[model samples]
Target: MNGPGPWGPAVDAQGAQDVLVHQALMYGSRHEYLLTAVPYLRAGRRAGDAVVVLVEPPVAAALRGQLGRETAAEIEFLDAAQWSRGPMHALASCHDRARADWWPRGRLRLLAEPVWRGRTPLETREWKRHDALLNVVFAGTPTMIMCAYDTAVLPGHVLDAAARTHPELAGPDGPAAAARYTAPAEFCAECDAGPLPPPPAVAARRSFATGGLPGLRSFLFTEAARLGLPEDRTLPFVLAVNEVATGIIRDGGGRGSLRVWAEAGELICDVADPVRVLADRFLGYEPPGAKGHDAAMWAVRRLCHIVETRSGPQGTQVRMRVRIG
Candidate 1:
C-alpha cells in the first residue's frame, strides 16, 4: 500500500504515528464536490486505509453515481441525517464502526458532513460543539477525517464556524492548513460562554425529588400540550425532559427544579440541581462509551431540538427545547 500522500504527513520510518487529518471541504458545485472528495477517497484506498463516508442522502447518491456502485461499495457509507440524531450517538457510532472494522493498529479515512442547511440554531450550536470536541475525542488516533460543508447551501456563519473547527482545508488542489482553526479547548469555551437565551417567562414551575419523577412527567405533558407543542412531538419532548430530570435526581443532589415555558414557537424546559454532576466540560459532546453513564443525556440530545447545560458555583442547569406547533 502507498504511504501518506497529499493530505497528511508520511508514516514515520520507525512506525506509524497516531495522526488526525481533520479538513473542511467548501464545495460550490457538483464538479467541485467530485474534485475535492474523490481524490481523497482514492488516496485512502491506495494507502490501504478503511474509508467511510457519512453524508446526506442526495450527496450519497451523487457520490455513488460518480464513483459507480461497485467502486463506492469498497467504502462504507452512513446517513448523515441519521447520525445527527444525537451528537454523542454520532461520535459513539463512529468510534464503534472504527473498532468493529479497524482497531488497534488499523488506519482510517473518514469523511463526514454532519451539518446541513435549515438546521435549527440550537442544532447548529450543538453540532459545532460536536465538531470541536472531535479533536479531543480522537486525540492520538491514526485517522484522517474530512468534514464537508456546502458553500452554496450553508450560511456564512456556519461556514465560518466550520473553518474554526477543522484544522485543515481540502480543495480540488489538495489539502492546506486552516488559517482560522481554533484549538478545541478555546472553541468549546467560546461556545459554552453563550448559554441559550433564558427560558421564556415560566408558565409553570415545579420542584421534584426522585419520588416525584412521575408527577414531573405528568406536569411536563400537560404544560407541553397547553403550550401547543405538536401532539406527535409532545411525548418525545416529555421523554427528553424526563431524562434530564431523572439525571438530576439520580446524580444532582437528589432534588431539582423544573420550569416549563413557551418561547417563539418552541417549548422549553429548564432543570436545575444543587450538585454539579457533569465534571467534563464536553460531557454531552463526547461518546457515551468513552465517558460511561451518559445514556440519559444522549437520549435528551436525540429527542430534543436543543439541550443546553451550564455549571457554576451555584449548581448545574440543563435546558431542553422542542419546536411547538
Candidate 2:
C-alpha cells in the first residue's frame, strides 16, 4: 500500500517474535541508521529475537568483523546487486525458504521523490515515500525494514518515541508488525499534501582525482578554474601531459595550480586550494551542481567505498589522507 504519511514500514510486535531487516547501501558510514539498527539488533539479542543485516559486497568483510563470530553468524549478509540482477523467481523462492526458517532478506530503501514532467520548467510537489522495497523483495518472511542512513540521523531514543507514540496501523503487540509493510492500510494516503520538509543538508567536502597522469591533468584544470594559475607557469606542466600542448593561459580571475607526474601505477595529488570541503565530522559537504554534471554524488560515495575498503586488483592503492597545516 502506498501512502504519503510519514514514510516507513510498520511491524506489529505486540506478542509474537520479530526480525528487523536493515538494508544498507553504504558500507556503514551513516551513523544515524546504525544508531537505529543497533538498538533493534541488541533488543533482539536480549530477548532472543532475530535480526538480520543485508549489505552490499564491498562492506561484507568489514561487517563480518564488526559483529564478531557469534552475533555476526546470526546476521546474514548478501550482495545488493543480486536483487536487481538475479533471477527474480528463484530469488523469491529462496526468500520464502529463508522466511520459513525465520530469516528475512533485507531491503535497501530509497527515499522516494515525486515525478515531474510537462512544463519547460516543471513544478514538482513534495512527496516522501519511505518503504523498504528492496528489503521486502529479498526478505521472504514478515519483516521490519528500516533505513540505516535515516536511522543514523535519528537517535534510537527518537525512534523509540515514534514507535510508542505513532498510531500503530498494527500494534507492535499485534501480528502484522513483523510482516512486510506492503499490506493495505500500512502506508501513507495523503501524498497530495506534499513532501516532508527537505532533509537537513549533508556535508560532502572532498576532492575527486582520476589517479596517475590523467588525474594530475584533471586536477590542474580544476585548479585553474578556481585559482587562475598563469599560463606561462602552467605551460610546462601542460606539455608534460599534453602531446601537442600549448601553454595554458587565463584571461580572468583564477587562483589554483595543478601538477601531474607518474609514480608506479598510482596517481598522487596535492591541491593548493580545494572547493571548500565541509569541516563537520558527521556530514560531508556537497557542492551545487550544474546541468549534466558528469557524475552523481551516489557514484562518488560508491567510489569512496571502493577506495576506503579494497586495495584493488594489481594491489594498487589510492589514498586521501588530509594533512592539516
Candidate 3:
C-alpha cells in the first residue's frame, strides 16, 4: 500500500515468483498492526495466493470486522497464537501446506502473531532459534510469512532478536531489509552454543549396547512410572527414549547411556551416545524422507513436553522432558 513490501512487484497468472519473503512485524497497537497486515492480505488476495491468517481470536476478529465479510470470506483463518503445538510442528505444517498448495496457486501468504507472554527465557530462546531456522527451512519455497511481535509486552531482547531472525522488517510504511539480520545457520548455532546443564546426580543411569534395548526400555519405563510421571505420557516417553537408544545401537557407535531423573517438576530422560556429527540441521522438522530418520526427530519432539538436543566433543545427547504437572 505505502510502497512495495517484501512480496515484491505485482504477480499475475504465470508470473509467480520463486523467492521466500519472511518478515517480522513489530507492532504495539491495533492501528500499527493494521497498517501492514490489511494491505498485505489484500494484495495476496489480488494475486490469487492462498492467504492464511493465524493469530489470536482478538486479532482475527479485528481483521474480519475491518475487512468486511465479503472481503474476508475468501481467506482461511486459524484460531491459534504461537504455533499450534510447537515451532517444529508449525514448521512441518507450513512445509506441507506450501508443498501441497503452492503450485496451483502462486504462493502462500501467511500472517501470524507469536505468543510470548508466559514463556521462560529458555523457551523464548528456542522460539528465536526456530525463527532463524525458518529462513533455512523455507529456502526457495513460494511463500511469504510475516510474524508479528507485540512491542509493549515483549522484552527488549526478544524484540531485537526478531530483527536478527527475520530477513526483513515490516513497518507502517513498508518492508525493508533488516540490517541486523543474521544468516540462519549462524544464528541457529548461536542459539545452541551453550552447554546443557549436567543431568541431575540422582538420575538413574544405565549403559547399554547392541541387543540390550528391551532391558533399557524396561528400566526407563519402570523409573518413569516410579517417579510419578503421568500414565498417559509414560508410555510415549519410554517409546521415544527407546527410539533414541535404538538409533544409538544401530548407528551411533553401537552403544549409549540412558539417564532418567526428576527435576523441577519435570521428568527428564536423556540418551547419550558416542560423539557423532549429525549433518542435517532440520532433521526432525522436515517432512518425511527429507533426511534419514528425520521424521524420528519430528516424533520425538512432539512426544515430549520439551526436548534439548546437542552434539559436541562430549557426545551427542538428546534429552526429552515431560511435565509432571
Per-residue lDDT value at 59 in model 3 = 91
lDDT, candidate 2, 216-289, per-residue tens: 45655554334444455344333332221111112111222333222232222222222222221111112213
Give residue 61's lDDT in candidate 2 (0 to 100): 58
Best by lDDT: 3
Per-residue CA lDDT of model 1 for 1-325, tens digit only, reads 1244675434555566576667889999888988878878777776667888998888888888877777798888888888876565677678777777764536788888885556666667778878887887776678888898889988898899989999878888777778999999788778778555665564589999979988888898889878898889999998887787777777678898878888877788888888765666765555467548466676677677667888887788888878776
Clashing pairs in 1: none
Q: What is candidate 3's lDDT per residue for 1-325, written digit by digit as tens?
A: 2225445433334554666778999999899888888888888887678899989888999999888898799998887654655566676666776677754576788898867767777678877887887787676667788999989788999999999999889988677879999987787777778778898889999999988988888898889888999888888888888888877887789998878899877899888887576665555655565435466777777677667788877778888888777
Roughly what TM-score does model 3 have, to 2 decimal places?
0.89
Misplaced by over 4 Å in model 2 are 1-14, 17-29, 86-95, 103-142, 149-325
> Which is superior by lDDT, 2 or 3?
3
Candidate 3, overall lDDT? Answer: 0.79
- For model 1 the local lDDT of residue 73 reads 86
